[model samples]
Target: VVYYFQARGHGDYDSDFSDEESGEKSVQKTKSVKEDDLLRKPFQKAKQGSVVHRRFAAEEWDREEARKRRFHLISMDAYQRHKKFVNDYILYYGGKMEDFRRSGENDKTDLDVIRENHRFLWNEDDEADMNWYKRLAKKYYDKLFKEYCIADLSRYKENKFGFRWRHEKEVISGKGQFSCGNKHCDEKEGLKSWEVNFGYVEHGEKKNALVKLRVCPECSYKLNFHHR
Candidate 1:
């Protein structure tokens, strides 16, 4: 790589001067050329050096790309696990539990424990990140408790459609006519008739479809209504 800092002047007006004006212009041009060469000499002298040779440059680049892809995949997997762990933790502990904070029972500080676990978790792959997962769950629970007592269960992607809540004042039905629509729930008591809309494919063509349903209180509150 060679870099020339000073710009070179284009076009040389030689002393094929036809008259006085041309001769003066040629003299000025010659002077300018001489000055440029003098300024450039030091840089030219400094350019003498052996070529810089990098061993396995191509191999190193390939390895770097592979390392980046591996890191990305690992991070994505870790993040998905983290979210699931946090969700379960929030549901179970509700942020109100013993050992949520650093107690005197543990002799080491949080930082010290985490640093030690860096090595321990590597070997114990099964229970690698349980500690941090618990910690995060507790942290989120506290935040939810302080800000709003109710959880935004709707934001959770329990299904293709995020939760779309509907109150029961609208649906009309008779006794024993409605039942819980949720597959997970078994509410077969007094309920209002509801509907579920989804897409279906027929002969490779996509089409819309609707099904009559009866959602119970618990399932209605938790389960999603339709696809987003």
Candidate 2:
């Protein structure tokens, strides 16, 4: 016996049962016009410009969250290190770090100092100061990216977006006392290092970037070591 079920006024189909030659009852189901309409409701509500707006909003939110987290991780010791680096860079440019610091008494946190420098570089229209500010900004971001992004494999993988390392000829780029990239590694001493190239897609363009990282000789066999 076969049963044909008609959908109610809502336009959704109901389940039906059929008796087969094997003496077992078989069930069938179908979606109704109402169900199809409901499924398409979200797409219908999305207007032409809404997708781009939503994407921009999401990107802004991600950047804001990252900025907040980065600032939060800046401890007094880290901040001091950053300050010293900035001061040294300023001295190289024949400027007193104290002068820069004294330029803004209200800027208390590291974030404030960075923001002030960034603003000064862009809005103040000083060419020399602009170059110095660019160097300072690069160093500041590099240190933080190394500590928080590169060293933590999980975080690196998560925040890497679609960027990936392009394994070409392996070459050591710098000489320095550097710790292992693995956060869980027990090695505290400096080890040999290498700079690796990474590729990513941005704004419909392919771009290449490099990062210097060290790996523990003993821990090189680990899966995450390649990322370092």
Candidate 3:
């Protein structure tokens, strides 16, 4: 006689199966088997009073594939937004370059023309301007790499604009500032590193940002924009 196995999450048992059409059956329970080992075995017994819940492993794999597809879709949306910011920033720099090129032409050599062009490019913003993207990128990029083993955002070739677009968003939105972090100095250019160094040094002692980001008492002395 063919035997049917009952499925239970935590219970274990044993049994046999014959061709379903013939309806012939096996007479013996071959051996005691644990739940994990018995999965592929044919003609198994279910735990007493348990029901068989059949599952095809392919359904699980399909669910995982769907999740991956959704993730890529979200990433593509972010990429498009980043691309738009890059185009806008490029236009802004191009205008500045045009002005500089015209002004330098009379007294400038071929070398000066090239240098001025490069200067404009260097002075341009590093990020696309979209609110909250900078904050998200700041936390997301490192987390994604460490936990998921994903490549850096730099590897997203389709988003050639780079994560710097997030910095531009922060600056434009006023949620943060882009100026040098030093309080005494008026320099508008420097990495965000300087801001934390001058303003958040005491806060940095803690490895966690919550502790490191405590408000700087000295920052109140400077203009709010300078704190950015």
Q: Which lDDT values do the candidates have, in the order given?
A: 0.47, 0.48, 0.35
> Which candidate gets the maximum TM-score versus the true structure?
2
Q: What TM-score quantifies how close candidate 3 is to the native fold?
A: 0.13
- Candidate 1 on 194-223: residue-level lDDT in tens? 454545443355555444455566555554
lDDT of prediction 2: 0.48
Better of 1 and 2 by lDDT: 2
Using TM-score as the measure, name the better of candidate 1 and candidate 3.
Answer: 1
Among all windows of 10 consecutive residues in model 3, the one with the lowest summed lDDT is: 144-153
Please, what's the RMSD in Å of model 2? 33.7
lDDT of 2 by residue, 82-182 (tens): 77678778868787656665555554665654554532112233335556545565445433323111333444435442222211111131112244555
Model 1 clashes, total count? 0
When 1 and 3 are scored with lDDT, the better candidate is: 1
Q: Top lDDT: which candidate number? A: 2
Error of model 3, residue 106, in angstroms: 34
User: Tens digits of per-residue lDDT for model 3 on 1-228?
Assistant: 999888643346422322442343232223323445667556765455854344655777789999997786677777686665566777876544343333544685544443332211111142444234343433443332111110112222332211111233333432223332232322343323212221122212322121111112343233233334
List the lowest-lDDT window of 10 residues for candidate 2.
166-175
Error (Å) of candidate 1 at residue 125 is 56
